[model samples]
Target chain A: MKGMSIIVKKVAQLISGLIFLYGIYIITHGHLTPGGGFAGGAIIAGAYILNILAFGSDAMNLKNKEQGSSLSESLAIFIVLMLAVFALFIGSKIFFANYLPKGQLGEIISAGAIPLYNIFIGIEVAAAIITIFLALVIFKEEVKK
Target chain B: MNSLIPLFVIVPLATSFLIMILGKFINGFQKTITPLVLLFLTVLSFYCLLNNHSNSYTYAIGGWEPIDNIPIAIYFVMDGFSLILLCIISLIGFLASVYSISYIAKFTSENNFYSLLCLMITGMSGVVLSGDLFNLFVFLEISVISSYALVAFGTEKEELEASFKYQVLGGIASFIILFAIGLIYWRTKTLNIADISALFHSHETSTFDLFIQILLISGFGLKAAMMPFHAWLPDAHSSAPSPISAMLSGVLIKAVGIYVIIRLFFTMFIVSEEISLLITTLGTISMVIGVLLAIGQWDIKRLLAYHSISQMGYVVLSIGIGLVLLARGVKPTVATLAIAGGLFHMVNHAVFKGLLFLNAGAIEHRINTRNLKEMGGLSKHMPVTSGTSFIASMAISGIPPFNGFFSKLIIIIAAVQAKFYLVAFLAVFVSVITLASFLKFQRYAFYNKSEHRSTSKIKEVPFPMLFSMIVMGILCLAFSLLAFPGIREQILGPAIDVLTNPNQYVQTIIGI
Candidate 1:
């Protein structure tokens, strides 16, 4: 029974990992196409939810989840703020100006600051989604209590 | 002087994270620390508003400059309008935090409640201060998501259902808003609101204009909980913890919904007869329907929730009247008076409605029941809560000697002045209905005789909660004094000036 449980947990973890990666792909390609931070982040959070359902809350070793997620959100916010600040030194007249040269439309370098913002947004959103879900899971009333 | 611009968002965001850290270490830091931080932030925002000479200030995050006269960076823009909103956000946020100190203690894991509360504040403050359309959308999402989570904080079956409904509807709104932004970018190739406004001003009318306007109105209308798109409001507002309900109904909807709509209408879109008419009609419908539905509700919070929709209708109707008058090039003063009345009521509603929810929570806290029929004759036991609720009820019902009276008076006056006599009559009729409904609320919740009359086993809530209610109650009386010419001249007038003349806002910030 122990071996079977371990195998099931490993399979859930693997599947969740793949799903997380796919969410990242969607977020990165958001500005170029359709999917964006909110959709991708929700998808990633869905993966975590699936893993928790399969393995139970105690099976996974998530570190300081609140602090971890909050730091991630803060870092994403910092990046957005920094990008806007970077515009100041470059002589842009206002904040968040697309200082980088627009390479070409439909290419990786196009859309100026749009992709950068999408990435930051993706990080913030993913962290927030995960945080709320984790809070709900942790705060659940024990069934037999 | 201009440096204080970022504090509006930063203070709440930082305090939220700080509370999370402190909450883990101390036994009751979640209860104590969160309220202190909120109080400090509220005072700080007020100080900033008072000290600043310029009506508008723009803070570039990390010092980003615009390229080629195009704004690409995120800007935290503060003006008289934003300051008015910021004051509402911080004050209500602080009071909610204070009330939550006691109210949330009934639940386990107090940290989560405080954390989510702060997140909501952060989102709201950011929405008020944001200068760009996309940034506003982002902040709005943050607020909506946190609120959805907070609504389900109770973890009851109904709470879950309500959150789910709110999320689905709110998600659709966000999607529409995002698509609208994409369309605008596709046409204008810029995300900055100012640049978009400037672009539209320089060019002639375009085909995509109406589409953008409709999309934005629908999106914000959903957030604002306007009449046609208000299906999710009663459930979400009633299901959340009372303080959270207060936050949702009092200021959150206005900040994220109506404020954005007004800003965009004035700044980006040219005032047109069709849009104005649509807005007015919708406002009138929401006003009538929201109150009519509210009268039937016996669940105290649910009734209050529906009233929020009703009150918001008055706001929209007044603003719509103003916009219609302005578009027709009629009496500009009448239009200003109309918008001023709307804005004034917005502030008044935030205080009284928020206080009312806190009062409801107080009753619930002592008796552990939300059903009004189950509550009775507890006024002697919970005097502070009852007295404050009386004050809040009076204020909400548009009784004289309170903030609600002045604004409603102004709105009625403006309607009559603008020859919108029918609208004026409807406005008075709704106020009467609002009064009648709350009288029922008072009779049932506090004054009605019940078998549990001697069940005076309940004591008043804790100091923090009572203190917040008292302060808000005091403000309810004090704010009415703004109707006096001198006080109005000092605060409301300047704020009204900023809205009426959009150029003053841009010029003050850009120093053009």
Candidate 2:
């Protein structure tokens, strides 16, 4: 599909970076705040989707990135699972045990393993949403072809 | 020992992700990885069964133990009942995965198939092991969603239509289950099964409680494909690939549907005579109607799908009889026998029906058609498939010396001893009709002469398919020995004990 008007593309370019940054902030601070991996990842995916809408699918190279997105999504999930499994191996011999040292309560990294889980989940969810979106786009293009 | 509970969910989930990620780059990663994961699960499940036969333990995730005697974390409850389900899931899952090694070669994106299969296994294991009601709901959704995708994996027009129907019906079942969980949490103020049972024991029943009971039965009934809610089975099971059909019919429905119903009704809710009768009536209708429908089917898979409903009927009917006896506080020994019979039939159906579906797949793989009318004289060319399928058919029909016969005999004897003459009669009648329909299946599919010249070129299926079928066929005979008292007490006794005594379940889990 073709790109939107130049004005729309320019505005999306300006805002997408901010959106992406905000999503990262939300993910990192998830343990201390309300928004966690799912919410932040969705926001980040929304940013990329917005860019695709304004810049067009070809310009964004979404078709090429689909495989990468899927791979990363799977990797993210694997990492989250490994974190839990590793805790079982190292800490209390229990699944999902918090083996990391607990920092001060108000700090961003205070909760042992929670922030790490959130970060992995964020990457996974974002990649998953992007994969789904790209798949739909590719399917539409195929039908047109 | 409690630590092992999470492995059931973790192993499958992690392996699924790994296969999806790594299989994308590696040519045959899914083929090797999927079977290994399932084999590991099968061995682990059997190990759990042997070690935990006399003990039941609960694992609290993240060490979120209860405060003030109320469990706050997601608990994984492991008992004889869940272990029985675990064995069935892993065993059938392994065979189905092995079968898929060759069968799925025709489908594109083999990695996606294996990944989805692993995810489905994770969901089923999670459902069977989770102690919290909402956790069960979550896992149920996971399983059902994966299954919807798997059912449509073939991408045929009919496959898509069947998957759409399955998703809609399954979605409604999930919603109803969620709504019931909400009502339950509202009433008892706890999500843990043991805690809820304890709360219900201390309080008097209200109208809302009965409403919740009905809701749960209908909700889980749809998943289990109880008589009224079974419309999706014929289409969905027949349209999916053969191994998938086996998984759906053999283990999936039992794990998500019948298993949940039995666990919730027997342990969570106080059983009453009226509810017990309701369940039995549902079972009887499904038994009779399911077989009647099967007798007229021309498609091989469709015929087997109908029988799934019929066989599930026997299980629910026997268990219903047991519940009725328990509710009325009569014939405790008879009640135990009835429930044991139900459980035994459940395992037997998993083996034989799984084999039957695999047999159908083998035939379809060779002949490239599902029509019974189009097939004939196949036993000559495919001795292994025909031989194994014949054993499965006889076992399912309750012929003597096979597993089905022993389980059915127990149900019948239990029914007679309890003076439920009507149930006993129907059980025997259904067995006869089952035998008749299967005879038709054999005559038309394998024994009858074919007019079509294509039968001459038909050959046996690949080694993986043949191997799975043989394993399931052996299980059909081996599981019959559960009737012998020495083995029965070890495998089936603990499961029967947990169900018969609900109070013990609460005390064991809650340590009260």
- Candidates, DockQ: 0.14, 0.87
A99-121 per-residue lDDT for model 2 (tens digits): 99989998986888899999999
- lDDT value for candidate 1? 0.84
Identify the CAPRI category of the predicted complex in candidate 2: high
Deviation (Å) of B305 in candidate 2: 0.3
True contacts kept of 1: 0.06
Q: How would you encode candidate 1's per-residue C-alpha lDDT over B142-227 as one tens digit per residue? A: 88999999999999999999999999999999999999999988888987777777777678766578878889999999999999
- TM per candidate: 0.84, 0.99
In model 2, how large is the Cα lDDT of residue B490?
Answer: 91
Q: Write the per-residue lDDT of candidate 2 for residues B1-512, one digit (tens) a residue.
A: 77788999999999999998889778899999999999999999999898875558889888877787777888899999999999999999999999999999998999989999999999999999998999999999999999999999999999999999999999999989999999999988889999999999888878889999999999999999999999999999999999999999999999999999999999999878999999999999999999999999999999999999999999999999999999999999999999999999999999999999999999999888999989999999999999999999999999978999999999999999888899999999999999999999999888999987667778788999999999999999999999999999899988999999898888866872
The DockQ of predicted model 1 stands at 0.14
How many pairs of residues collide in model 2?
Answer: 0
